[model samples]
Target: MSKTRQHCFDFGVPPALTLLLGLWGITRNNSMWRDEAATWEAAHRTIPEIWSLLGRIDMVHGLYYLFMHGVFTVFGDRLYCLRLPSLLAMACATALLTLLGSRLVDASTGLATGLAFALLPAVQQYAQEGRPYALVTACEVLACWLLVTAVDASNWCHWAAYGTTVLVAALLNWFSLLILFAHAATIALARTPRAVIARWALSASCAVLGSLPLVMASQAQSGQVSWIPPVGLGTTLNLLMTVVMGALGAYLARTRLASGSVRVSLSALALPLLALPPLLLLAVSLTRPLYQTRYVLFSQIGLALLIGAACHALASRFRRQPRRSIVLAAAVALVALLPIEVPLRSAGSRVDDVLSTADNVAAVRKPGDAVLYIPAARRDTALVSPGAFTGTRDLALIENPRQSNTLQGVEGTPEYIRKAMLTARRIIVVTDDNTSPPASARDRTKEQVLRSHFIRRYETRERGRKIVVYVRRADDRAATPTSRCPCFVRKGSTPTPPGVVPTEQSKSNRTQ
Candidate 1:
């Protein structure tokens, strides 16, 4: 008897449903990452505080906050539910890309475009993340569709849609302004006559100028910031690869040569037009202060479209040289994909890993035991208290009176060493090897401060997250060293200074 072969359901479902299912799977088990945890806290602001909060910390994502205010009303702020909106937004983007690809290029191109976006690693990563990236992606496709439609004619409605879309896109993420530059550059390469190009350019220029006020406000609020160094040939090539062939963006120059259609090539070039200008500016900023990879994501649209074109152009290679194209695309896609999914899976897997670790370590009620954050790593695998491992009540349950205003990443956080040591039944501070002096220095002075000053209890490392528990020896209790005591400030500053209390924290702030 012949085995019954199962056909994939993606073939039968409408693009819209397939798109949603794909996004849902990507987002399904992704526990909220740290930055996303922060966003959830901010977006659920009360109506009275919403306006003030939007202007203060979040100038660009104001419109999204307003939408999330609606999300909070129904979903009531669970992490998965809060992130549901972003996944839905990404699904909309996949559907729109399919329609746009089909309408702008051809049916096969359109079908592939939707499928490509649906499976793309970057799209998958952001769809799972609990932030505004998916929403921005959605706005990007809609804006591009609107702009392309408007350029085809002077349809007043399309132009109006273009304006509204531009404003909403900008509000979702300020970098959406880069779309204007992409449009300008693409129009120049368009086979459209110079007269027509000039007319379209003028129209787009007006639309961008109209958005100047909001853009200027955002710029002033953010202040000029940059850290990325000048992008060399290597970085440029890497970015180009990521933009054009989905994960193929990693090996841009290495990929096989293909003859891209004029439409596709022009579209591909739009990516550099959108991203390169800002990237170059960021490179120049390396000398002064401002570049973060995340801010420039809106530019990836040009890259994504370009990659779709490249994929379409090069896909036939897979048919002829089945071994070559399949092998190359597979290897590149796998390498590019690991950096995202692997990390996500590792982090998610730790939910159980941390729980298992908790089972073995009995909570020893030693009086000096404290929950110390050794050297204070930038992040930890799990945030919840280790039930048996720490032998103390979870800080979440602790009546932390001052948590209301405890800003994340503030300089003074690790200063709680002294207090945690004195109070915790089994004191344990977690840290990685980050704080040790360079090997050349071999500073025993600093090393002694840790070993002699703080009594070591237990140390463990699993999958890069480290936990080191220390106890304040009974003799050391009399010393009352400021380093390990609560309210005991680090040498330079007091833990709770005179005027540092919360100004007017509400009930919501207490929950954090």
Candidate 2:
């Protein structure tokens, strides 16, 4: 093959495979989890509304939301449209990583690195998600590739590209700024020329300055991640294991490579990239919780590179049959990852299925039924599937989501909500299966009122969501079983006529 064709072949295959893997079961059975529902809700809003929402919350995701708004405008709102950007972004990241690996090691190693990245469970999970993490990962890999080129050539144009890419990545998610420390460590460990270090410092400084505004603005929205748990023993053990694996890979690669064989040392680049971001985030989380694995999804690129180096080293040991050794290794990896890859494409893989919850609500809903979302954020279910809630009233909502410029619409005050609940003859409650107490006083009031005055007539749990039908307790006969309540009719059964209540035995017989 010609040199150009060889380069194309080396870089093309892994990304093509990655794209195919991402496209496999891309819709997750048309289930949009809460996080993706947040994206869907924001993307469908008008630009002005999105801007208004950013001023109050999610300013960190402001740029991504605007980008996705444009996407939705061009493509129309659909599950594939919501997630295709992430899938494409991940493929781009895989391609860039392949190019970077080829520069740092050899074409064979580069191919291996790209293929390893495509198989990572985290990469697969986020690639099919409708979120910014995959985009952030792509930008970070592109920035790293530009950084390596800039360091090699010491050219102003390359440095400028590196700085611009870093700025874009940080804007997508400020946590991506952590990649800078990894890059700096690579330069320092490699003992690069002072001129190159100077150029890198200038480029990195400019990028940081450009991202300062977002960094500052995102602080105001920091409370959004308050739910992230503090660092624990399990987290520490996982980080330790990751570090051990990277170190082992680096050791193997160093023993195999001769000096001057590659422009950038694979160990210098991959180890820091794999280890620094998550380690630093975990250290910070010790004081104030900020660590979430998704925030540093780009680190997987580092792991992929290290795996590539380790595989290259091991394959070299089979000097008489290196090609067979590589084939065997690839087959083993594919077999090991198959089980994980299959489940990731399933709807049950996510925390909750918004579509399933919405479908259940739509099937059992009756005219004039008041709907309540416990903890309020569960309103996302209705927002993402508005048709399912068309005939019902949102009893606690003081303003609709778009009107309030919030993901969840503004809710009435506790007293107002209590009064609204009192007026409803039948209510539908949509909530999660979390057993924790309500986080806010308003949520507490909602639970208190429901427990005191309403009785659950019918309830079903599906994919971590709880949907319940409740009817007002009869004032004269508080001991009446919910089976006799008008709203207690089983799904697909004839509804009891208005002002007529079925006897418990009659309802039981009918259900049987």
Candidate 3:
């Protein structure tokens, strides 16, 4: 092919491939995981409620939740509808990555990078998630592209576009702001013109200033991430391996004919964008636990670009036998990526696998039975179909989650929970498999009350959750015999719905 034709081919094919790859299993009806469940809960609320929620927690995600609110408004709550934004955003990111790589190196390298990005397990994983990370990656990649254009042209219009995108990325996820520091490395490494440097600085300053309110709010709500563990040796080693491999891949992508500035800028970018966030997060985590792999997911973009460049360089080495060599190289890469792609397409791939959990619950639950979530967060298992638990009670529930405008609704106090538990003939307890025995005071009390009064009937364990049933002892009659919980009703409503409460017919269906 002629040079012009090759460049056009490189520009067009990768994005189309990325879109096809991203949409393949995008609608796999996997149960919404905990975080996505949280998104569902928040997005379903009124605008005032969502704004009020950000004042207390998840301020970083407020914009994303609002965006989803608009989506859910038009699309309803279908699984595919919720995930479509991510699918589209990931495709956009893949295209932007191609453009960014081409700007840094050449069109062929850009195409290779886009293909590599589409195949990355992490990218595939988030592309299907109903959360903000995929959007964050898209905006960050776009911001990088704009930054390069702004620097090259030293134009206020391009700088403004870059700055605006930076703010949007930061608002979508505060962790995305870390990219500015990586961009700073690019600026310094290339010794960009003084006018370009001033333009870059102004754009960055605008981004930071515009995003300041959200940053402060998120800081105050930092405890939401307290579950993240302090950095240690194992984590340090893992990050080191990721950084070293990424740098090596980028180094190999370098060609003898590429511009000096492009090579230097690519080197500066691939390393820090892949390495700096985790290291800075690790350092901060030494004082406060804030490090998590998902927060730095955008880093994978840099790694993928480098690896793609390397692929292009390798294919170019056989210049005398180009067509066959490139085909073989592409085939080998696809074969290598198959293992990672397979699981990502399945419902069982997620940690919580809420669909399986719900199916298990539906199979075992009897009428007149009660359900309890060990840590309360496990209530996500029921969120998708509140009606699935119809004819039964949630013993510890204080308010219906949607009614209360909370993630999974509130749990009653331990004393109230124990009292609530005593009324039911059978109870189902959902617990996290990753946690050990005696998870919380509520969990410990539930275990103690059940063991002391009932017998364990059956247990089922899953990848990320466990479910166990307990039946009331035959001799026990001291406890009250209420057939339904009062808590599931909307506030101020008087009577209970019939099928939703336990009945003889419901009990007969269970016995049979």
Give all candidate RMSDs, comma-separated: 10.1, 5.5, 7.0
Model 2 spans with C-alpha error above 4 angstroms: 1-6, 259-262, 319-324, 475-512
Model 2 Cα lDDT, one tens digit per residue, 1-512: 68788678778977997899999999887677899889988988889999999987899888999999999899877788999999999999999999888888778778778888888899999999999999999999999889878878889999999999999998999899999999999999878999989989999999999999988987888889998899899988998898899888878777754443655687788889899999999999999999989999999988999887788778877665443465467668878999998999988899897877777777667878899998799998887777777668999999988888889989999999999999998898999867888998788888898888987777667777888877888742554555664443233333444443423221110100
Candidate number achieving the greatest TM-score relative to the actual structure: 2
Residue 60 error for model 1, in Å?
4.0
Candidate 3, residues 243-277, lDDT tens digits: the string is: 88887786676552245344345666667788877
What lDDT tens digits, residue by residue, belong to model 1 across residues 329-351? 53476467666655553334322
True lDDT of residue 150, candidate 1? 64
Model 3 clash pairs are none
Off by over 4 Å in 1: 1-30, 49-58, 191-234, 240-285, 288-293, 310-452, 460-465, 475-512
Worst 10 residues of 3 by lDDT: 503-512
Sort by TM-score, best first. Answer: 2, 3, 1
TM-score of each: 0.64, 0.92, 0.87
Question: What TM-score would candidate 2 get against the native?
Answer: 0.92
Q: Which is the better candidate, 1 or 3, if ranked by TM-score?
A: 3
The predicted structure with the larger lDDT, 1 or 2, is: 2
